[model samples]
Target chain A: METPCLVMDADLMEANLHTLQAAVNRAGKALRPHAKSHRCSRIAHRQVQVGAVGICVAKLREAEVLALSGITDILLTGPVADSTRLQRVPALLERAPHLMLVLDSHETARILHQSLAAHNRSLDILIDLDVGLHRTGIPPCDAVSFARALAAFPTLRLRGIQAYAGQVQHIRAFEERRTASLTCMKEAGQTFESLRRQYPACTIFTGGGTGTFDIDIEIPALTDLQAGSYALMDADYRTVQSRGCLTPTHTFTPPLRLLTTVIGTHHPSHVTVDAGLKTMYRDGASPVPAEPEWSHLSYEWFGDEYGRLLTPPGTRRPRCGDRISLYVSHCDPTVNLFDAFNMIRAGSPAETWPIDLRGCSQ
Target chain B: METPCLVMDADLMEANLHTLQAAVNRAGKALRPHAKSHRCSRIAHRQVQVGAVGICVAKLREAEVLALSGITDILLTGPVADSTRLQRVPALLERAPHLMLVLDSHETARILHQSLAAHNRSLDILIDLDVGLHRTGIPPCDAVSFARALAAFPTLRLRGIQAYAGQVQHIRAFEERRTASLTCMKEAGQTFESLRRQYPACTIFTGGGTGTFDIDIEIPALTDLQAGSYALMDADYRTVQSRGCLTPTHTFTPPLRLLTTVIGTHHPSHVTVDAGLKTMYRDGASPVPAEPEWSHLSYEWFGDEYGRLLTPPGTRRPRCGDRISLYVSHCDPTVNLFDAFNMIRAGSPAETWPIDLRGCSQ
Candidate 1:
């Protein structure tokens, strides 16, 4: 394989898929893996084949790509307000009839309804409730009023609610993560209950990530889980302990690894690799070398296309032309940087999956 | 304009081009604007038209894109070592006769030469020297020896030296930045002086960025500048004081702004904008609202698709659907996230420029 290649361990990936699917299944909740992580249609198909209710996407562009790839049931997790973007909904709905969108504001709901009414098409939507992460969504306190106001938009059907506690996804301790997740999902559950009273048909209450997968299942209202990152875990999630395990063991192995060649070895105490800030997303924890022997060495950002592996005393210094595998800090944005993922089955090349939904953050 | 749109102010961009080109012209040095910042062939062509000798790219993929777009003279600034990538040189050279590549290691030079020799093609090469940034380059002490070793490869023609001090590019104080840049460039100049003895054709001593454009020109051995971010100034560079002025001010105006819409207004003390970590690059500094009136509001990352504007006491919160323009923290990676630049000329829509080399980080 070429340098700076994104490789996925197929065997490990398959194991991770089954592990997460079984966990969600045992909890009696649907698994809707977020496509934002891998952005590959092949992976989405695999997730669906292994019993996924549907796939969740943060952008309409992702939903459109996955829908065109024959994904019947698709849900857009983020709020879509712009008229230009909302106009793209009907075409997407035509491709994926079970397409669902999340709406947090009345103005957005009204505009989306108006856009849908023009085509005489009605769409299913989830009221995005802000549990704790104040990025988007209606506050849990206003969920009842917001769901009631949705009566004005007859073209938009109130399906359920989406309250993803993104901020609580990476809490290190299992207990702390469960407590934080329960606090947020409890409020979301109450809001869903209130909405279910008025609209008894509202059954889908989805929102949970890889960190709080087990804890979120405890909430009686959360019917489906939006757990991304479990399929191809990253360095950031490796620290989080297993939810239902007796010991502090990671449930999912990091399948995604960036293969970067050492381009420069001029620095006396370090070697420069091709993967840097541009190659691996550094929005969260710093990326580490995948090899256990290189654990002692620390990674540093050299530039956009270069990173440095600091070689302390007694550490083996990597030479020029040496290829190093790296566990990315964040998977979503790092996967977005690549064109395709080189699938490795049993440590050998299998097939390549194009990250078709990449750069789909529209 | 649509939400989360990348807009380029044409007038301001033109002014920035002329200002930097005129500065380099006055300095008696060539300006080879780094295309890695904009990654648009149109912008690269404009820079060349404005007196830039050619363009500098950080990756071979970028070079291929620019060469395909009819850019003749192109210099790839980063080191290319992998055999697979080295095999691509001859084809690129066919498109661009004056294409130059930077090499820091003899192993890379040997491999690159072997690839070029098989195709019976010779390439113009620059000995990349590591002045301070421990990225990709040979140490100044090993430059002459490394350049001498290149004599073993007849297919590679030694042209000049490339010593980019990316570490000194963002120093806030002009004096401190000048001192740091000079310390690095002077060493590079000395190395160039030693190499010129054996290779008389080694004239191009290109290495300088937007931060140290003025100070680097003070070094007589420095032949050209590799300033990339000057064209589209970012929030990080805006903090840098001007070089040769009595008054402290930013020489180039930030022409690039990310236009985003307020997607949610559910948070009592804040409004959520559509642009987030996936939209803006937060590697160096935080992106600020482009509008001066909303300068008091602070921006926070919401998630992949949203950001929160902290609305404190007495500050008015933006409503849903309202557009908020943001000044990106870093221009290069941020530009890589977008597909096109919505060109705005005199406050009116002009044309769109495709970020053709956007994801060319291989």
Candidate 2:
């Protein structure tokens, strides 16, 4: 369990967490998952023990590492706009009492209601709108005045409407990621129907990802999908294209990878390896070799701790110390360049996990 | 010190660590300074207190986080081939007895002489050759039979060459980065004159970086340099071009940047911010706005934690929460995507540091 590390495959990630929680509970929605893709509080408590009704996290340091690992329904999804992380969102709502927070602006809902109204606490939020990913939301023509200025922040509680469209999550075309996930579910179902008729505490709309999780579970105004990289499939989401009813292909099974070794060969066709771009996360591509006998190789970036590969001429290469594996190309910044996650199973390793919100990216 | 952190100007990083340690001690070389580019053990003990004769790590978990921060002369520079990192290199050479490692295989010098002959210790090594960045190294006709099979590894001591032309460190033309750093200092000066005529305890030939630290201090068989991003200049080494006698354009002074904020504006021009590609390191390109009043803006990546910017239409946008400052495009895998660093100085945030071998990237 070493070579450049990060393994996982524990029975193919518990069969990709029981096939994306039985296809987001057969599309009636509510899976949550996305703990910023395996920042591992034991894979967000095994995605809330396979049902996953809560865990999104984009950062309040991944909702304080999945709320100090107890994992009470998290949500975050970006937008905290720093008052040193909105004063740690009322101490991450005292370790995740269903903490929500997505905000888009009445100056970050008055700096998160003056840091949760000086901790008398009342947080929940959501409002982030702009479905097209202008990178941070608020603009379904100003989601009803930013959910009526985050319902005048008496410790902020609007509780719904995020609209994620992270640039159509790698749209390599399956009807253009289902027409851009139905145009971000028709503008987040018109800003969750005008903030559930002027805010009856807007009932949780959330967002979608893992390449529009089967067109955001057929979008009936997304009650909650937030999809984090379908239990670690990568190589840029295994080249997208999973069409309509979701099984035209890739029902997801990459189960992370990486391993590595082969620390240098280079003569009649390069080799190197020991991972790179600092243990693989070069944004959109390059990290393949899960051995199809080195499928004519390819890789490249050889600096932040080497990578190379190339190997064209006769094809098979790979010698120095050999090992290999690979896959990655972006599984949440390659699981935030690892601090743990070995796992494996019917082939070795077993348990390691620890990414505990890796570098948390504060 | 929050809005997307990673600051570090502290008097332009103590004047870029005393101008690259007085230009590698007026070209007679020996500076070392890499610590995998600011994996900060308090910036490698402030680059070994301004002169830097130690530190250049690439992994054994960044030489066990710079030998548990006392940093007793590191070196590492990749190629360990993991038997769980060659059994932690004789317990990191008992906390770095001037560590040094870099091999180029005899199966990694018999897995570091059977893990330092089962800890009876004795390490120092090197060999690693092939300078033109054929990643990892070896080929100078197999460096004298790989330093004569690492001198029959009686606990291994060779210690001479290491080559490292990391693809000629971002060559944006200064006589094509001095003819590719003088063709990697003429094949590492003919393999350091044939391994100093067969290892006369091969006195440290090392390599160079921070774009061939002024063409490897005019290469006379480089006795050390190893320049890690000249104390943090970025935006792709500020597009290189520093000519022969150096300093015609950028003689290092970027001193890291990132700050962030303006969390989404998008109106007449766009803005976003909250850093991106998981806080800047999009392998060689994106990050920019270190304000010339937003110098026609630009940036882009907008996803793994935002970024966008673009503001051209009559410029000057950055509205939302304001704060600005970007710069980055590569400062060692964006200082391994942050866990600390702040530092600043006259503009604020006086001292945070902590990137202590960030995710050590084993």
Candidate 3:
């Protein structure tokens, strides 16, 4: 019985998987959930079993991990440059065979072409377009020519398009979030139409994450969706615009919780918990208490080992040795801190679920 | 090999241990380097071998980890609570026999006393004082009474007073940092002075950390300094207030590096790296290129696995597959994210150093 263990709900994870699958089906679109959120091959395999056409891995290493686990189709949602990753790519492709890596420009296409030619191999490549999020991806207007050039490359095949609308993911307002999601997908849709005309044939146009998963589901040319983080929703995601849209029936249940114990009573109104910056992801914000009345209590991170609690004056507090649950601010990185998620059912002996992806930082 | 692994320079770590030991010797302060930094029992053992009086563990689980490794003298610097940690305490004591757990309140003291008495065991304790951190520890005014009252607990021994100046750690002004460190020590000194006068046989007085290792070297009343992270200086610690006084020793050898490879040439001026927020600590800031000038590339987090780079317009770019070395922004959490440290020596193949203290997060 370790304090600060990651508690995961298997039932909830199953529900979330069903929920995302239903979302894609209801929208009549292909599904390709991102693997970065969970980084679990078991989860990846589950996604595929539930009808996700492919998986989106944040890194080639992640792809390698999943590919070895028998996930055939994967999209490298993020950029890849390093020679080591390039050399490793062919091996992963050799294993997965149905892999597709995303790229944003002709330069990336050219690099892939040259490098793959040197290795006497070809790759399935998708042109990532800057639909709305300007983080990566080429401009949508430049998609056709670039897609054509990448399509023409002997060492690479022009798949379709990839656009992840990060800005839409956290949108809390229903109408506004839906509008933003549509706006982002609409921009990518135009590029897809142009590319479709340019090639005179439809390619595999894919993109959209949990935030915009529903948005791209019905997009005219969008062949699939790349949704991650829906299985284990975080506090921040719960506050997003789509939070309401994800009704209990449609909700991607949160399976993750940080089970930490009261470590010290520093103030009569404050206690220090072992889950701090090292245990929790303090990037978005501190987690909210699971108890209703404990709302007044907030977490203050002063160091890596200690998380401070500012409880309401005269609030009935738990004594030393009491356990409290924390809803992580964000699920992805928070889970990254854990080595395993202790799967606990109501009144059942907890089972250890190794977060196989926890330290898979590579 | 994983693209980004937490690699530790054993040579550098040993050198860091020596540097701290030398400072403690020169300053005449007792050494108790905090174990939170490396979170490795092996590293803590090495520190003890290098003449450290004891090791400071920030959490109950950390104490368990080190204690299991046969560390006799250990201090739980923060708080200890939860039935699991409490029940485990006696077991830990049976093995180590000399472990001190800190408590900031009588409530927790009562819990510890009752819990220990139930087990017919007693544990040494330190009264943590809020020297300046304001996060944990009782206020200085309340520390003495808190420490004095804990003496009545049959199963708990109020062995000493623990005070730490977290702000002083970041005070870059060398003289100012020293001044702040001394002032903090003086404040704690006053509290200890009160205890010294009241309890004529007060046998223990402990305080100090990596930032104040030199400052507390010879403090008359302070018996220990809990400086950790010295063995692995990160980008954040390198800039701790730019303290002008403590001629910033290049002592923090940059041994731990994330060996990443350039994955894609998405942008013209700069290439996107395969490693992103997932691979390195971005708390202080993104990892700067080890050879910044040669790379002449600036980084922006594009996505989970993508670090956007903006190279100078005319600069030669990193082609696909170029290996890039990066330092973590904060060493501890970054280390916590990795399962093992790749131990690379000058002539040997990289060996795997198990992050034995990793899952000990609980």
Per-model lDDT: 0.87, 0.77, 0.73
DockQ of 2: 0.24
Q: Candidate 2, residues B76-175: lDDT per residue as tens digits?
A: 8776765666887787788788887888778767877887888798877787787666776677767887787677888888878888777777877778
Chain B TM-scores, listed for every candidate in order, come to 0.96, 0.39, 0.91
Cα deviation of B134, candidate 2, in Å: 22
For all predicted structures, in order, the TM-scores are 0.96, 0.38, 0.87
Best by TM-score: 1
Q: Per-residue lDDT for A1-362 in model 2, tens only?
A: 55678887788878878887888888778788787777888878878888888888877877887788788788888777656668777887887888887877777678778877877989777777776666776677777866665666677777778887777878787887788679767867876877788777788887777787877888787787778788887887787778754432478878788888776675677877778887778867678877677767888776677777888886678777778888888888778877888887897877687887876766
Give candidates' CA RMSD values in order. 2.0, 19.5, 3.9
Candidate 2's error at B39, in angstroms?
16
Model 1, span B23-118: residue lDDT tens? 888989999999999989999999999999999998888899999999999999988877788889999999999999998877778888888989
- Summarize candidate 1's per-residue lDDT along A1-362 as a digit string, tens digits: 77677999999999999998998899888999999889999999999999999999988888999998999899999988777788889888899999999988777788888888998899999998878887787788888888889998899899889999999998888888888899888988988998898898799999999888888887888999999899999988876778566453478989999998887776678888888777787877788889987788788887777788999977788877788898898888888887899999888998899999987877
What range of 10 consecutive residues in model 2 chain B has the weakest lDDT sum? B241-250
- Highest DockQ model number: 1
Colliding pairs, model 2:
none
Ten-residue region with minimum lDDT total, candidate 3 chain B: B240-249
Error of 1 at A154 (Å): 3.0
Q: Give the worst 10-residue stretch by lDDT in candidate 1 chain B.
A: B241-250
In order of listing, the candidates' clash counts read 0, 0, 31
Candidate 3 lDDT, A111-176, residue by residue in tens = 667777877888887777777665567888887777667666788877678877887776666668
